[model samples]
Target: MNVRPAEPMFVSVPPRPQRLLHSEAYIKYIEGLQADSKYISNWDKQLRANTENTPVPDQSRLPTHWLGNGAGNHGSVVNALWMLRDFMMKDALGINKTI
Candidate 1:
């Protein structure tokens, strides 16, 4: 009887529900935000200040949570979406590397 070596097998892995949010659509959304005039202005200001060695704001003394008119709540939703997008991109890179 001859013994044969086992061949490596590739398995298709499905993304979790949360990770499904990270897709091309999400990347486009982020790009859209970057394209907004207000967002660009704010980002440019921050970058310029950082390059000029401006003192950092004292965020350590700020309140962790503030009760506001639904703005904060909406911010949380946006944050979750971004998180999902990041997760999905990372997962994609990992899959690409394995292949």
Candidate 2:
């Protein structure tokens, strides 16, 4: 049985693009949220500046209640802060990789 060279088939497969979160509508929503008084903060301002001229999608900011509650609990906040600092140092600065 002879297979006639697969008939030189031309497959027109479209490329599957990655779905990035940074769309124009999403960017507009982020800008609007940044302008809102309830969510605006120094960090938010900085983030707005950084993201304004770029295409990076911003993560949700920590809520005000979280900050207030964390501040109200001294020991827990301290522990959590230290843990976060260490985590950032390790993951960002590549200090510790024992995970």
Residue range 1-99, candidate 2, lDDT tens digits: 977666556877899998877877578767767544674334444334422353423324323344545735545544444445456555764645553
TM-score per model over all chains: 0.26, 0.22
As for candidate 1, its clashing pairs are: none
TM-score of 1: 0.26
Backbone clashes in candidate 1 total: 0
Question: CA lDDT of each candidate?
Answer: 0.51, 0.51
Worst 10 residues of 2 by lDDT: 55-64
Q: For candidate 1, lDDT tens digit of each residue in 8-74?
A: 6977799767644666657866676754366533445433442136542454533334423323444
